[model samples]
Target: MRDRPVPQLPLALILSFLAVSGLLLLEDLFARPFTFLTGISFEAVRRGEMALLLGLAALLAARFVRRDLIHGLLERRAGKALPHLIGDVASLFVLVVGAAIIMTGVYGWDIGAVVAAGGLSLAIVGLALKDVILAVFNGAALNVENAFMVGDRVKIGEVDGTVVQSTWRSTTILTKARRLVTIPNIALGTASITNFDRPDKSEQRVIEICLDYDVTAESAERILLAGVIGAAGISLVDAPRVHAIRLDRDGVVYAIRYVIANHDLGLSSDHAVIKSILAHLRDAGIGVSYPKQEVVTAERRIRVADRTVDRRVLVQQCELFRGLPPDVQARIAEALIEQKVQAGAALIAAGAVRSSLFIVGEGLMKRLRARPDRPGFVEERYVATQAFGRRAFLSDLPHPAPIGAVTQSLVFELTRAAFAGILAAHPEIKVPLATNLARSPTLDITHATEVSALEARAERPVAFYLSLLDAIASSEANAR
Candidate 1:
């Protein structure tokens, strides 16, 4: 369109120009005036057919061959199909050049004045709409460079969003806030762009973990790495990593970095990774460390260590002991010994003779049973304050399955000798203890009196108590 010097040039101008020679040949009045003004020295100017032949040849070349070659060249150079405006410009330039050749070569006219006028007009347009022209060129260049495609998430300057459309003058972006933003191509040309689509769609993120300085770097890394790996939506191909940031007064700070699926899952994916880290921390028996100062206290009979749970608390957790007097409970608590086990370590072995009653104080203890038809073992987890080994401690029965530490854990264990002392001082404890040992451990005995009151509950209570006493006597023999 720019190649046309006249603001209103169209098919009518081309048609009127093609008919000029016919009218010149038909009437001497028109011919004489055209010849004098244009100064045409055409040897065949009097022939209308000659003018038509020249016009047809020019039209054929401009319409088919020249336009195709120009469009093909532009597309190949840009490595993509260019816009419709670019093709239209190319076609119009070809038409204008053909008309110029006809005017100068065929008509014997001087075109210097016409070229000068067209150049001056173009200069005026270049100065007036320079910003718009620059934007158009920038848009073309952006496509050629393959900087980013429509629908790609990108950050240009302060605007971060997905590109909705790219045009000759500007690009439209849809932000996360659901607002539409139109940015000029000139701005994109000057700004730095971060395209999420490049390299891959996955995004890299991080979480921080702090642990007591006493924990080895290797252990911290292993546990933290396991936590990140256990989370879903993580890209294992990238492989998660842990780095030590710095050593604090309270502990060592570690950064856990992992790659997830995409930018859209940002917060939800991070939350999953965090949950995994917490579970692994518990399993590893490592507490997240924080700043704390030790304070000296008065009237202390060796105050319980911050890291250790009170044994009395473990004793009170047991259903049988919870019903007993505090002094009687103290006797059992005094005899209890604190035992620690690391993750995956066996605390109770299958078929091993049970000599102690144990209560979990911290972390998890799990029982593992071999599958009847499968090769692997199934584990059932037991958490804090849950007691185990009542059947083993009250009778001579052996542990049916292996119990291991699922996480770093503490268990308060009351051995046969310690329990024997409590039973000796409190013989009435044996009735319920014998009942538990004689019946299925899974039975929920709300009252330890469930067995002691059997005399009233059962039709033949005498036979039941006698048999219960035998089991109690047998249990006492092991304590001895």
Candidate 2:
């Protein structure tokens, strides 16, 4: 390397120099008599050195400002780092004072009397601010002890809010309604602080549901578990078990032991679990205890498409369908076939023909499939009750997936062909279906590869296509 370039001085340093020069120029103008009386260059040298120190001070202040040191210090203190902050400020003050002393001493001035007087004045000031001094000491002690941090939801006596700031003299709390209250640190440190966010060995949420004592505990438990699992932001980290604590005057009290995700509101999870439970109980002829009494004569059961059931009871059980427009649900009900999947049966096979969509009425199924890119791929899946599949009916293809019974599964099967015919027969249904499948293909076909596999997999084409044919035939029959 031929030569290294020197870095340019900062603008702050240049401004500092200008300020110091102005101070020195002003001193020179005022100290003319002192300069002549001294017979020495004291005035000139003092002016020069004082100018330098003033420039240095300006430079230091500018550096602090640019670095955001003051801002950070204030924020840290506000965020309950007061003791550490106070220590930092004290250290900086001492260093600056020491430097000033050294600079003054070097210029042949006596510092002993000045230091003694300063100490005396500081002691007198501290006595006057006894409460403030005590508060600062308390803050320092609290910082050393570190009783709590910012963002902690705390309660002290009647007060409750998040710890927003802890300063040398006071601790500030921001309440839920965005109100700020300052408590002197001396008082704050002495008070009992209850930190809500503190980690506990066991955490539980209590959900109070008053169901009639006539309802079995088992049913209540099932309902509670469903609600907990369905709610979003709910962590089943703990066994989501419900305990029947007491048969209070109100009803059966259930303490639902549920963990939420890190202090988040789990209203969705709660709602889902509760809804599922209530639906299940209603199906079982159990009712949730609410302050009400009503009596109505049982509606006469009538045979609709060879199945006799109360329409009102059916409506109440399927709350999921309740959200559907009355007309749409009526169409679905009309198209719905009472198809059943027996215990240990093959409902649908992966990579086979598809025809009807099946919605679970009862029981569980295991879904199996290969994991792609794995050596010697294998199938795996576990599905419970309330699962639905529509690809088979829609595509008119071989089951594109396989479902095996874990337990006997009863289901409502909607055959695509049957649904279509039902729509055509019932002009009212035509509008909605037409709207839903507006862009859908008129006909769905199976993959050639799956078609070939179907004959090999089953004894006959008819046997393999029983489900698909059944669906189509039902739809055709409904239309007729």
Instruction: Using lDDT, give the best candidate's number.
Output: 1
Candidate 2 residues 81-146, lDDT tens each?
333345445555655764665557555556776677689898999889989878877887876776
What's the distance in Å from true for residue 421, model 2? 30
Clashes of 2: 21
Instruction: Kindly list the per-residue Cα lDDT of model 1 for residues 395-474, writing each as its tens digit.
Output: 65798788877555667788866666677668776566544433434322221222332222223233354464455556
lDDT of each: 0.65, 0.54
Candidate 1: list runs displaced more than 4 Å: 1-116, 232-237, 282-480
